[model samples]
Target chain A: MSEEKRTDLESLGEFGTIDLLTKNFLITRESTAFGIGDDAAVLERNEEQYTLVSTDMLVEGVHFNLMYVPFKHLGYKSVAVNVSDIAAMNGTPEQITVSIAVSNRFPLEALEELYDGIRLACQHYKVDLVGGDTTSSRSGLVISVTAIGVVDKSKVVYRSGAGTNDLLVVSGDLGAAYVGLQVLEREKSVFQANPDIQPDLDGKDYIIQRQLKPEARMDVIAYLKELEVVPTSMIDVSDGLASEILHLCKSSKKGAMVYNAKLPIDSLTSTTALDFNLDPVTCVLNGGEDYELLFTVSQNDFDKIKGNPHMTIIGYMTDASDGIYLVDKNESLIPLSAQGWDHFQQ
Target chain B: MSEEKRTDLESLGEFGTIDLLTKNFLITRESTAFGIGDDAAVLERNEEQYTLVSTDMLVEGVHFNLMYVPFKHLGYKSVAVNVSDIAAMNGTPEQITVSIAVSNRFPLEALEELYDGIRLACQHYKVDLVGGDTTSSRSGLVISVTAIGVVDKSKVVYRSGAGTNDLLVVSGDLGAAYVGLQVLEREKSVFQANPDIQPDLDGKDYIIQRQLKPEARMDVIAYLKELEVVPTSMIDVSDGLASEILHLCKSSKKGAMVYNAKLPIDSLTSTTALDFNLDPVTCVLNGGEDYELLFTVSQNDFDKIKGNPHMTIIGYMTDASDGIYLVDKNESLIPLSAQGWDHFQQ
Candidate 1:
């Protein structure tokens, strides 16, 4: 290899490589309203309706560990993660196409277990498995899913549409999935040391389930519809609250101040985080794989959701000059930093 | 993770996993006309147009050898292969979505080089970049791209639509890409053995180019449009001609008789195959990644394409009882086997 041509990926990081890969991409079709910058791409077919499409690829060894992970939950979470993208756009997922590449190392029964979870998730989410491609892989299993959905042109929400005064609300609690992973890893290590030991997973069940079989939050979409709520901007917190909130802030051209007191931490997640020697608040900010929707609501609809059992008003949008900040219980304003899924850190 | 729940991916192979994963997958919406069983999945929207969507994932080490393959060609080929799937359905090139997961091993500039080729392909095919996800991988780079294109409801063809008495035709030539790959691999081996020897690629440019940068036959879509001809069935020859023909047969409930002499072979591919002591016909039959279009036309339209220079009428579709046969140069009938890119065999 040429000395100058020896390129390393770490130097680019995640966003840097992404920017490099897509810089020259041109939107040629008139139907493509938006492309790479948003959570989900927007395509318009007519004046009345628009189509939303997004895709995600999960590589074995990179995304999961088969040793401790169930194929069934893997299947469910696979669909849920992609579906969460659609839910973030305030769109109902109509169809999904799954493509899988596997080596001969998997068994028919094992695959049956995987698909059973897929079928179960399909039944749960009301998504159709319309089409997919099946091919052999040289290494571990890879699942790539593309979801297609539609919404009225006027109702489709994007990450860039948030206004300055919009309230930032997150459905469900944060840090649960992160805490769940801590428990799973702790048990796994203990079990590894002593094969005869049984896992002591009592109160951490919710967090464990959050990490294992999280739902797409389509219920939130339906609930929002019934409540006549349309988020000014929306995003799913797959990569933690801080990173997601930053996305909303960057795209919406606004800043936010989320109160630490207002942050929802499930009892189980908080206790588990404490057990792991981690700060629960920091876990909420930096923890990922929550699959919860974080969205902005106008002040006009505040009263309608203020009493809701499923929603929590974590903060409100602020002027760009104020910057993204978090007011802790000490009444100190601290700048929010996104430490979500830094896959490129040395 | 339980001791009782040990499952390996290789036990299922590729097809078994697919069947297991999509066994219960259903099409709930009217727009999804076909699902899971064909080359490209089909979707219908609005009145006169149907959208064809297909996705492919390429993982480093598994899909390509970065040692020999340039990153730029990898990006270009990624888009080309996905676009070929839309063309497989006799659809026009339109919009595509790309998702990539990279490790920390790459630099920002490297991604730019990759995207530069992607943008070139987009400009070449006139397909818009829609939306996709960019994330981190623990290992090699993984790229998953989904291309969506529109086809007139009447003109859109499926592999299952062919019938007895239809004529089978292919655009451009076969096996050139595969031969080109052979040449590149041979050169790489030599280069690895000793870097002092430069690549002996002189007079071997055409097949090498074909393998490195194969173009999807969008021109055939235009040609059929101009000729006012609609193919009864169509598919891209990505998995070699034999496998594609088998797919057409299995889907369309028919058999075929492909004349060996009529198979198109570029002069360069034939000579290169000879140099490698390989049968040119076999390379053309079982070689893959050509990205050429193969379709079955109605008997009535045969005369319309009788004098067309771009397309060659290689064979005719027949009853399933007739069996899939290859008429050798000696005029003897021989059963055709699909030795196309067997990941298991690889």
Candidate 2:
């Protein structure tokens, strides 16, 4: 008798698994300008424009908990995350197709609430909800969204386009969304212990909102354009900051140096991390789901964006030989590591 | 407290549920040529072409039983179904994005096998796999696919274009895939009852293949183009012939008369359906998942496709006042009802 071999999915991680599976898929269409290995796939649209396609799936329990997360927020977050992917490519989102599968446990009203949130997001982003699929699942709810966007041929950015000495910039403060999730989880635990007790989420509105209704940084994209400073490379911070930096460095075959003092962390997030007995800097570096734009611009273009309040310069790219590192508070060059969320590992 | 209102999803059904949820979403993008209520959404691409986007979600147990379905076939069918939507719009599929959520129960080898089938389908359809999302689920496997296609501006077809005197047509045979599923289900029950049973799937290859690996009718689109015949209205037969016929009637504001004797049922399907003591006509009318093309053409163009081996002319369009009906073998008119598979109702 012959024995069969089996490999665990946890060992490969998400990116590794996708690489192993899609590595052999040959690109046979002239319309496919780019395939995989990016925030969104690029396709040739016309002489002056390129189309961007991005998709994401959010499974209940795996991505969110219905106990504390409302149906409307889930729907809105799903669209926001996918739109962020388009923004990561330096494109303007124009349309979205959302497909959802839910069990009978959710009534028609529940789904209606979900659609309301989706409609709100569409209106806020000015993207049309063009199409979708609705069907039944055996258990839990799964929402998948695909966003279509467009960019000028000359303005589109990619992770592989970062240049040596480019300044790394990020929009909005970091670690708030991660801290928001922690508060939600804690409140959930307290409620599970006693159903009669109300969740005490006072004075944490900013962080909570960051987690519940994080907006895609379309405004930052507009600001960069107004400043006449196009990013050489860009990515969305769905994963932790450290993990995204590693991705940029690997894709462009460059190294990076970030200063711990320059890391952006909200005061509420810092205080909350301390209350939870965790380091705020670690949360900013490793906590995810921020949806903020992490990008790099040429050193020469720094003058245009240096005083911009919406964005901050966190680091600079270096030669590959320098290796990726963070200058800690004590002036020590600590090698950066990625501890981003991996659902399979969890 | 006021009594909370709750509506069951089963009562609304799939189409009704989609309409209710999306009725309030207004299209805001100039690029959005058409949105929702069709096999695929259309967007303005350029001077010569219009882009098409179609999406579908398949869930385990509700959509397919893993006990009987191979992983590779499921992967292939997922892509095929989305491509079928593009074909229904008379478009050429150019790229596809496939997102899958699976639990830890599935090993890396299982996913690799699934991707192997996806790659094969991409090759066969001549479409590029541009991008997708991969995530972990709490239970079961869910696959969502989005296909992008393009059609010449002059050749684009829509469901609302049928004329009162148009001829109704269908590609390939019907009822085979439904009967094939029945055979597999029976075999599965027998296997569950007794492990040592050498199942009898003999002489059932045609029907079984139809159910397991149904191909999108892209060939029909090619043939129509070659014959210089453009369908006035079209839809993919994913939800049974009767249901699709009703969709054409409702969308085009016309009535249809289908002749039962003209339904293209393969000999194998007829015999197998009879063996199960089921009416073959009923299966043809209500059993879904055929992945065939159902279309209407102007009577003036009938000569172009009158004797095509791959297509069958089953009926003709009538005035909306005449109502939709089917002429049975007895030459008696009977109102057509949609008993097509509805997962929510099931």
Candidate 3:
């Protein structure tokens, strides 16, 4: 074979390929007031409102293992994860295009179970299941979903909007999803070794469910509106809490001082981390796929939302010179790094 | 596996899965004015326009063979084919999200050449290259692209809007893409058996190019406006001429007649089909991925377009009782069937 005949996808890497593909794009339609360059692609729907569009692709074996991943939970979590992206933009999801590429190895019943969870998510989140393509795959299943949502123009948030002193807050708990993954992996190994052994998952249900069926915090978005609190910046918890925090910080050209003690982690998540011989604090810092909403609000609105039960202020934004750091329980500062999963590495 | 677990995707079919998945989807958000059943998903954007969202998945082996298909042509065709879908709704594409899962057999330089073609398309189409996911695939390469486009409130066309007596027109010529496929396959066989034999493709460039790098008929869409003609209904020629005609017929609740003599076939396409000993008519009717626009215009504008190049008025709409029929050169009546490539069958 000629040496010139072979090419690798990784030389482009994640960032380079995106830059190459999008460099020629010019926004033409008036309706497309904005395209790309953000957490979600923004569109003008009305004089007062904007539509946000985001898409994600999840492939089996690469993204999930069917050995421990139920088809129903997989479906529900896929929808929820995409919905969380829209939520990070402070947009209410309206419609979703859920396209799945399946191999013939999957049974009709398996697909039905997957769709059942999809339908359940549509009902819970109030997003319509719009149009999608179903095709055969030569390998494991591939699910790609494009979610569309509308938001009042002024209320839309971007990760780049964080400012000095803006209180960084995340809704619900963290690290549970990552801990749950460890639990599932352990159980899968045990089951493989001895098929007769049932999964010893009694106290780990909360963390496991969080990983399997995480919910998008659309309710928190609505609540912020009722309290009349507009976030200065926002992002969703997907690639672990630390990586998401770093994204917001880097995009905003600022730094963050996250309080490790204030991290909202479920008791079960903490327990399971210890039971699995993992550090609970590390789980809270880098455990991923929580699908929770992370945002920053002005200190003035703090009085109003501080009374609310769902909000947890985990950190504060800092000037770029301050650098992003975690305030450990010992009061020592540690610079953050993104240990998030990179599919390219797989 | 048990018999119950052996039900394949083909057994469920396209409509079956769609019916099952969308059964319980209740429209929750007001912004989701419409969902599921439409040809293109309707997303309300500006006060005067709507954004059309659609997605398609192309997998290696299932969609194309790397041996016969060049990466550059594959990239261009991918974007063009997607843009054609937006054009089908009388909308201009504004943005796209390209998600690809590739195996390691491909190198970084090969991906660069592929993106080089994608960038060229983005320049030609004037659409932004937006956010997308890149991951490793276990087998072959999988590309899922979601295209977004916009239309004027009054100008946007749908599959359901064709009226009785509407004239059916198809842009450019047909059968060439399929004939081109045959030529490429034959050449592939030649090369496989005798490594030293040069491919005899001197006069078959047009057919091969048509097969490899088919252009989406955005020109027809632009010309229609200049001619003061608005198609009452339209669809792109992705799933063959016959399947598209059937879509218009089914959506309009009307039958149709297509005169085979009126079917346009380029000279090179005809020559290539003869070389392959394939029926020209069969190629035109059943060939997929033409990416040409097939639309229905009002009868009042037929005379204005009669002399124009790049289009052929192949058929006319009639009452449902009339049924869909095609007249052959020998004056034989043949019932039309959507023998377009069924992905399920593959």
Candidate 4:
């Protein structure tokens, strides 16, 4: 018999793996307006509206560490992240189905605490917890959430819609969540060495909350709607700024030039990065899990959001020939690469 | 500080755990027609139709044993089970989002095999492969599928809609899948004891296929629709006949009396059960994973499906005060209990 070919999963990476697995699937449903290769799947709902569906999975040890993370926060973050996908499409989330697989080692109260956070997110987002499956696992906890949202057909944004010269904007700040995760990991190490030693999490509430209980940018979506500024293209910043920029550029068949000086990094995040011997700019570029919206708007609509404090105009889209680059503070153009978190590599 | 009390998850079981966790959640979305406590959640799609969404999670070790299960069959089974939920609601599945988490120990080829099965199932069910998340896990492979379906508002069925004196009907033969699992388990034990010994699966093809690749009874739904028979209440036979009957009774506020002699058990399944020193009737009552449609029809519509070959009239619904029981072959009445598979207790 001929030897079967074997390839490591690390070689394909996450995106490559997904593409390889799903490339052969043909979309045959008329209701499916868009299938795969986007923030969420778009389904035709009505003449004026579209339904959006997105799914996310978080595996224990790979996605979160329970040593420093509370169950409630984990639950809240799981829902928030899936909601962020809907927000990326500029849609209003209506319902979510959360499926969790947990080992018997976890007590009933632990799951209850998790659901308490889920309930809070449902209340905050005004989304219904429609249905889900709860099953037992042999190892760690696994949470998979699917969010369904709706948007006007004319207003829905996709990553492949960016036009050349369109302004690239991002909501809120960046790098806080990643920096906060570092602090938690450090504390975990200290507590592991000496169980009696208390974690010194004083004055790090902002960063810690950014990591544990990050909110989806539904507020930004609402603000955009109020301003009547529909983005040409959009994606959520779950896998670092550089990675998201690359995704938008690749999907839109365009290039981008983002200014390092224009990147939004909270002062606390900057100082925390420096304290950990890391550069704030690097963290803002490559650190992930911010759950902020990164999008592009036409130059004509720039005047509406020009001085908006909630959003930052980081750069503009360029011709595809011009490779994606970051204009550093020193006036040097640095090629951007996605050093986003790859759980497989870890 | 006083020690916090911990409750074992085994005490709640699967259904109890979900109920306890979701009891406090209030539905706030205007689009939510019905939330939880059904085969699928119902959402308002349009004036004429209702959208249905259901999710299921399969964890390795708990849901399937890789030693005996082919990755392709596992993938196919996962999608089929989720589609079964849609069928249970008397809906047509249109789209599905499949999220998977796998350890690096699995090769890229393994995932391809898995997705091939997913693709095949998508083609079979005519469900579009939409969006999903792919991530890494610390241990075994996990597959989570969310199926999106649509049904006419007037034809939609729910577990809580059955009326007293409604005819209880079931599609396909019961306990075959469970018996197939036993045969596979026996072969696995034999293989483990002596590596050189080949599996004695010569004449067990039908039963083995039932266990590995059970199909959702969408055909039955189509037939019912063609016959103008709308079920009053419906549920997929996933957790055995007794458990499903109990769910229907609890949801509909009714009771049932199932006849053991009337259960549609195939000859092969019966012979296999006898070989394993098991009662075929007992397996039919408590053995799960049949993926058959168990539904109730009004007495007026019984004539339409009276001589149908695909369906069997197992029993009928009764008043809530009548209690649920099983009439054995000896004509003795016995109260039925849910001995369906419990992963937590295992």
Q: How big a share of the true inter-chain contacts is recovered in candidate 1? A: 0.60
- DockQ (C-alpha based) per candidate is 0.53, 0.71, 0.56, 0.75
Error of 4 at A173 (Å): 0.8
C-alpha lDDT score of every prediction, in listed order: 0.83, 0.94, 0.82, 0.94
lDDT of 3 by residue, B36-56 (tens): 654577777767888888788
lDDT of 4 by residue, B1-346 (tens): 1139788899989888998999999888889999999999999999999999999999998889998999899999999999999999999999999999999989999888899889889999999999998899999999999999999999999999999999999999999999999999999999999989999999999989999999999999999999999999999999888999999999999999889888999999999999999999888888989999999999999899898999999999999999998988899999988988777777
Q: How good is model 2 by TM-score?
A: 0.99
The residue-level lDDT of candidate 1 at A235 comes to: 95
Q: Which parts of model 4 are misplaced by more than 4 Å?
A: A1-3, B1-3
Q: Which candidate do you rate higher for TM-score, 3 or 4?
A: 4
Tell me which of candidates 2 and 3 scores higher on TM-score: 2
- Candidate 3 CAPRI-style tier: medium
Between candidates 3 and 4, the one scoring higher on lDDT is 4
Model 4 per-residue lDDT at A154:
96
As a whole number from 0 to 100, the lDDT of residue A83 in candidate 1 is: 89
TM-score of chain A of each: 0.96, 0.99, 0.94, 0.98
lDDT of 2 by residue, B226-298 (tens): 9999999999999889999999999999999999999999999999999999899999999999999999999
What's the ranking of the predictions by DockQ, best on top?
4, 2, 3, 1
Clashes of 3: 8
Q: List the residue pairs that clash in candidate 4.
A: none
Candidate 2's residue-wise lDDT over A5-71, tens digit each? 7788989888888899999999999999999989999999999999999999999999999888888
- Span of 10 residues, lowest total lDDT, candidate 3 chain A: A1-10
Candidate 4 C-alpha error for residue A144, in Å: 0.7
Query: Over the stretch A161-224, how does candidate 4's per-residue lDDT look in tens digits?
Result: 9999999999999999999999999999999999999999898999999999999999999899
Per-residue lDDT value at A1 in model 4: 11
Error of 1 at B293 (Å): 0.9
